[model samples]
Target: MKRPDCPSSSHLSSTTPNAGRTWEEIVADKQRTDAAKIPPEWVLPPAVVAGAEARRSLVGAFIEGLLDAETCRITDMDVPDLVGLMESGAFTAVQVTTAFCRRAAVVHQLTRNMLEIGFNNALKRAAELDDYFRAHNKLIGPLHGIPFTLKDQFHIKGLETCMAFVGWIGTFEGNKGTGKEREFESEIIKEFHRLGAIPIGKASCSPETSNNILGYLWSPHNQQLSSGGSSGGEAVMQALKGSAFGVGTDIGGSVSMPASFNGVFSLKPSSGRISMKDVANTGPGQQIMPTVAGIMGRSVTTLRLVLKSLLSTEPWLQDPYVVPLPWRELEDCCPGKGLAKSKPTFGFMENDGIVIPHPPVQRALGLVKRALQEAGYETIDWGPPSNLESLQIHGHIARGDGCPDVWRALQLSGEPEVPQISGLFEPDGPRDPMSLPEYQDVVVHMRDYRNRYQEYWMSTAGLTKTGRPVDVFISPVTATAGLLPEKFFHAEYTNSTNVLDFPTVVIPVTFVDKDIDVGDPNFKPITETDAINMAAYDASAYHGAPAAVQVVGRRLSEEKVLAMAELVVEALSLCKAKGHGPSSVG
Candidate 1:
């Protein structure tokens, strides 16, 4: 299969002339048009918007306070429930789609996370699905009539995918006559449409989740903290219940970090599990550590539903990059079927021996450990190969080209680099690209690192009483519960998974409690990065932010990873019931 081009949107306007407009004007016009796309009935009053801005958190009660009971009831339902309701004729596709579109519109107005709005188009598609259901008297597919949003990297027939770049707003990836603007769609988009899912909008993403188009996306759980970047907009949408689920891309912790910070569930499958053909990306030349698409939802079941449905379409037939493996129900079973009759053992890594997680994160890990122990699972201390190696390999491979393409994209629209990514380039232009030999040397190092890591994992069989390696391992999703502007220090927890191509899941555990998650005043630093990361932790500032942990499995083991994540969720629930879990607050 031929890989399609993943270009950005053109900077054109229907209301204003495309030419003779400043970059600022173009950006402003797009924002205005996007806001205008929301239905008048769905628009929030200025007072409501002001009120939401003033609040510290907009999740749960705060967001529900702004919606009618019907809207709340409809939007709160997960994908399975929504599908069941539609299939039983309890709700029409238009009704479900409209409720989410209205809520998404409100979410955008308050949070400014939306880059392209397709409310009208989404409703039209919903109506078409309803008509098809009426004519055939059967559902379209597993995801029929379910509404979703994605990071702006994806292309939808009527949606603009600029990925937050101002120069590519109206044209096809900054070109004037490409003729693919709003006409071409990504492979995943096509698959979702066939599965009966509707695309409602696209989200803004940047290095730290803030962007030129939508400003900084704050976590709805705590407005003071960041939602997380590159996929933060989608995370915010999911946290706000703006859509049933969402899609985001991750190269290094982009999807997992935001999902962690925003307090939602996410599955970052290994590369090739999902199709990324024709998706807009920055490091297209760096195929060695290619970006992979990830799914974010309120529940693991929703994530499973999406991945399973996509595989049913045989995505590899259209995108050679997608693995031919279909969803394996047998692989999802735990401690069952043709294997060990004994209880499963888990590998636990409290810290990377470099940077320790913040207090809330530490508490969250403790909760998981205690819960699993109470549930009769053996937990082992996990000491993998140094993340320092993954860090070196990741930095070299991810930016070996010096990001000239990113620099060129910004130049096309004259938009100043967002503060989050300004350090990537020099004063005037990109730095020198690495030589071929140097790049190859790093690649060899990466291979050797993967080998050593796998060997270390397999060697655990000698330590376990069952004579089997750990079923899965658990660790912090990041060094902090929620990001505080530019205070991010470590990515190895997530970056290692990317280097090894391991499938991972992010499960929200508890909220950050300032009184309990206080910093250790007498702590000693293990490394320079460790000291810098720990010093940036502010319990009072991160109060009420969500804290989460990551569960990792070997490469292409999405089913097992997701199943283990569900196990973690169940264990946490059991702990909470017994008052041993982390505190819960709205």
Candidate 2:
């Protein structure tokens, strides 16, 4: 009081504006200046840091002791097993849903993987299924109370699809005046609801699962590495068994890369296979290489169930963009049946001959090759049109128009551009838009690339043991086991599929082992990027990263992709039996 009686020079000095700041403004300025500093790459996002603080506030002291054997057991069941339990009346939907919800809550506390929690609604829906089962004495559908999560881009009724945009927090697509706030629903989400699937929550997502709101999504298997982006949150959820299955979208390798990095199975079907209506998109105007919905889970069976169930709903009717094609119970294309032989020939591309796969991936390719050889399948070395061609077409059509839409969406919330997307812009703002003429050239290139790719694929007939075109081709999903943040140098593996509009199934075949997966120094690099990529390899750093291969089939040939993926999985299982290397658990 005595100091204040002198009109406190300290308070006066604080009030004295440097330019125009008031006393409170000066305090806020300092706080914001401190807050604006970016975190180290290795550190989790501030939001994740805050989640840990929140959990501590709520749980007090017992959170550490709570992770015991029984808790883990309940969390390990896959979608099919959970559905089997519910169908047999061994467990009601309510019981299964409650277990997963509790486990998911714990996972979110540890990993900050969830962006929205629909626990109350999910439990209520589960109870309804239990009652329906009691009355009908039959399961509702194949999924029947299966718990799952989706990337925040999917619109779920009663939940806001903020999709990590601060501007999208309070409204539909960041528009406050739009009356459709929580009322809109995505077409694929509608299919899930109709299939008796329960939505546990929404997952965090970003360029690589890093954003201002949700921060970084860490791989639950190994926290030191990234979860893989755009779909990283979905992959992490599946890795931790936070959900029985998860859904994410891919334009480039978003789904496959994340699924591979997290040691899970995923299917990135061609566009129109799964409807994307009402889903939030990055570049809505650019439809050349449109993003497609994909499924990630612990097993191929889970993926099959989701795909079959959705197709049964006739998604094409509600979504005009969806193809009217129904899921075909593919006639056995096995050699003795559809073909003249018992085993079909397959084209194999160990690497694109551009970027060489790392040691773990090379080992995985060898395992698959040996397995197929032992099983009596013809494996022809696949040499096709350069994927470098797809690289050029992918950038122009995918990121052309300077990504003005992505920039505008980011601006709505005043959220800073994530470091992953920082390069998309100039120091000032997004780079100049691609001119109309230039953009057209890219489209033409993409079309030509597809034509040449198909021609090359058909050319496999001459190389096959059976005079038929190779059933499917196998290749690495990425050159590296898991990417170091921003270290991804090649997309030829995945982008080639997009360019060809081919269907692909990603099967995790092995994991990185520092002991056996050391790169050979004598190995010659095919191109400069290949040499640079090899130089970036460190055995210890990549240890435990999942190694996967892509089973690629012709456009609309999902059946063949799934079947061939099953064959690859079986072949690898046989190889593991011979005591050759690491095994694929999924």
Candidate 3:
């Protein structure tokens, strides 16, 4: 009955020399190693580090104040601007790489977000890129010399991918004597390398965005709030402008939630758009709803550039799981599109009816709706299939196997499970896995749910004045602007997209304001989960945290989704210019 990937019961009793060490010691040693990777010149002073620790926010002027003029100039540019600057000979690859590495070093020291640091090697590679540019008198690719980071699940040459598991630290995903340690690379890394994007480091991931390796990652906008995970660290890095762009993996709301909480943009494409080959994951056998890679960046354009660049590599040639679709150039879904003379219609879902969003999130949705209407786009109220279906199917499909591999990985070093995931296993061991028949039934249920949802979407054509389906839908990224540890209730907003295999883009709108965003005095709960979720919302605690909305398109419509997201951004910008946007606090 033992699964091939799960560790045997005998292996649980067999402990390595490190088994005697406390988990705290293992984590501390790893932290020290990451800190030492930063060069002496890039290290922050004791006073500056102390100040940052004492501050509530490190984003905007705070983090930028620590950098020199050149570093500030280089780090502030988006991916396209960075590449254009390098190609124009106005800035060399080394300059851009060093600026981001230095800023990332500062971010790691303050937030403990980085799991592995590869700055020295990154600079060396930047030098080689500069040499190539000098010799050829042209750039290498669309992403030439743009520095970036990844979630720790990715394998990069010379870097270890522990994925926040203490037991997996020194070894390759918990196995020793594997020549592949620091020698092998993930398929996406190869694609990024070919595109000339530099990998500066790897970040931490866990539920609630905390792990033993890097501790908890907090929002740069409001340090009191959690950076939502399991892609929290990547979001924190993007918020601080540590890199031009970063990559993270998302199954549920991992990428979208963090990006929302951190005031950044992210694209969580449907499965198969991006490759997951050779990547380490806890639920490796969950193929029905596989985890897809997502891109986090400072702007919609940056996200578009990263995805388009990756598709240019034809990843399907190397990773069989990847779709063979190339980047399709689509006209903006604006007024000029050839589909119809009328402007695009938007399907707006303010809440799922089960769990209502917090006031800040509601305000964000209102702002987006008004902005779109003011910009000549029609908005329709959207009511898709209930997310209760996704809620049931997500658990069975994502962790139906009882997560024996996760328990086995923790057993490697005898490290205690972080509190966030401790409930996954019984005191003795992992819970019993579901039977094959039951699991298949849930899969069938999931397929039926997706079909019904699509049918509902198709039915919208009858509701819209344009006589066509809405271009894309808008909704809250999460129930709250920022997460308070252990306060998360429902994830259906983002989880439904995963279940339906829909492409989504997160667009930051405004920040939480305790002065204005308060609970409605006459509000009544629709369900038990809604009451619990609303009771957890503390406007005072969530103040200054970013609130965002997501633009969701049908499956395999990343290009159209990004374009529509840009439209959302444009609408919001115009709204803010006219002083009609939601009030934001620093």
lDDT of each: 0.87, 0.77, 0.87
Model 2 regions more than 4 Å off: 1-71, 331-341
Give one digit per residue, the lDDT tens place, for model 3 in 34-145. 7778888888889888778778889878888888988898888888888888989999999999999999998888787898899988999999999999999998889999
Comparison by lDDT, 1 against 2, better one: 1
In candidate 1, position 581 carries an lDDT of 76
lDDT of 2 by residue, 1-586 (tens): 0000101112211123323434345334433432332123223446654545433122212333444555456557787787888888988888777777776766676666677777778999999999999999989888899889999899988777877765566678867778889788898888888889999788888777876565666555445457788899999888777788999988888898899888889999998899999899888877778899999998776787789889999999999988898888655642223332357677889888799999999988888888888777889999989988988888877888787766766666345566777778876667898889988888888888788878987888888878888888999998988876667788779988887878888888887888889989798999999998999888887777788888889998886687777777776676678887456645
The candidate, 2 or 3, that scores higher on TM-score is: 3
Write one digit per residue (lDDT tens) for candidate 1, span 253-359.
99999999999999999999999999999989799988999999998889888999999999999999998999887443442242323467789999998899999
RMSD of 1: 5.6
The alpha-carbon root-mean-square deviation between model 2 and the true structure, to one decimal in Å, is: 8.8
Clashing residue pairs found in predicted model 2:
167-413, 208-229, 335-341
Report the error of model 3 at residue 479, Å: 0.6
Whole-model lDDT for model 1 versus the true structure?
0.87
Consecutive 10-residue window with the lowest summed lDDT within model 2? 1-10
